[model samples]
Target: MTMGFNESQSAFAAALLDPGLPLPQGITTARGVTDPLRFAVYRNNVYVGLTTALGQRFPVTKRLVGSEFFAGMARTYAADHKPATPLIIHYGDDFPDFIAAFPPAASLAYLPDVARIEVAWTRAYHAADRLPLDVAKIAAVPPERIAEMSLVPHPSAGLVRSDFPAGTIWSAHQGEAVAPVTEWRAEAVLVVRPAMHVEIRFLPPGDAAFAACLLEGTTLGTAAQKAFAAAPDFDFGSALIGLVGLGAFSAFEAFEGKLP
Candidate 1:
């Protein structure tokens, strides 16, 4: 009997998921017979392709888990969560959450946060480009008006906070030899794509607070005030220079004005 549209789609999904399953109805085989082997080959190819794509998206997660474990997790993740978009580059948005609840990786509590950082890095690399705010413009603003002026964060800016030293772990794996001590303290990371490359930096608590406030549209003066509250020794001058050098500020305008 000819399968209906829904039935045909169901059959195709089943065949793709389980290579041992028979071919979907209305599909042909080379030998003019229902050859499960041919369909199995096709199913395996699909899995392989998806697995490779996931690996590329989460290379750090894969490396931390090792080849065998990474492959196994990738298989389970792929099966449960199929891509909604045809663009492979946009895949793996749910991977960080997947790693968090994955039974096999339950022991590595920091794995998910590390994955988040990697994902942010990838996203920043593809974010919209904009010319950094001119330093002269910022300097031109009157001291009296600076308190009401808001700074805009770059399009590619992202902040990550983790209980574990995710940035340290990620950096260590990338060829730096560092101790893997579990301090159980919060570490903040700032990611910005100033030019062609993505730059990752570990942010001090005060600086992170300041940056977060600025990103939320707070005036520069307000952000600095908050930073000083967080850390009495907060160095506004140094932090501003560092942020501007990293291209964190795309533009500045009056607090009520639209970002330029």
Candidate 2:
């Protein structure tokens, strides 16, 4: 019934994350040092390594705030949120919300959204790969039945909505900015990795709604109608073509039946 730890795994893990606490009961150094200070080396190494890993995962967040500030903030965050999984690449998914609440970063209200965009990018990059949908097959479907078809979104497709123009902020970091924008605007972002690269695009209002529906398994006709209801000027043709260009879908099949 026992597993990896000589003592309790919980006790060992707690001491690793909490440097102030005494070393776990069964641990010992070669010199037989009894003081908690004996465990300081392991504590420092674990904390430093995890903080560095988080900084790598949230490069934009680090850039958004200065490195020193980010490091300090990262320490505060890592204290409470221990790594739940062995994979560090996907760690810090909640750092955005942590930033939103961190008092020093509160003035920069958009920091959380920017972090979310970064998370989306990392997730898309690691998502499973699949060949792009065949546009010709979709084109051959009868016009009337096309509405009843449902799209199978690629594994890497994602959507992010923010009250701030996070896409523009992210772009500014990529050296694509000519000048800083003064006015604030709401934006919706599409995150996808069609091939080798992960892309972030500012999604049109209707497209986000329509794509949301498709991703949720709604019929294409119902999705488009709902999108049009949200934005009367929604353009189905352009959206479809653009998504196909991005290779956002893997297949298009009838919502409830096989194609003839």
Identify the runs in model 1 with alpha carbons over 4 angstroms from their true place: 1-23, 30-33, 176-185, 216-229, 258-260
Off by over 4 Å in 2: 1-7, 176-178, 257-260
Clashing pairs in 2: none
Q: What is residue 119's positional error in candidate 1, in angstroms?
A: 0.9
> lDDT of model 2 at residue 180?
82
Clashing pairs in 1: none
Candidates in order, TM-scores: namely 0.82, 0.89
Q: Report the lDDT tens digits of candidate 1 across residue range 99-218.
A: 999998999999999889888898889889988777777767777777778888899888887888888888777754545656656788898898899999988988988888987888
Name the lDDT of candidate 2.
0.83
Quote the lDDT for 160 in model 2.
Answer: 79
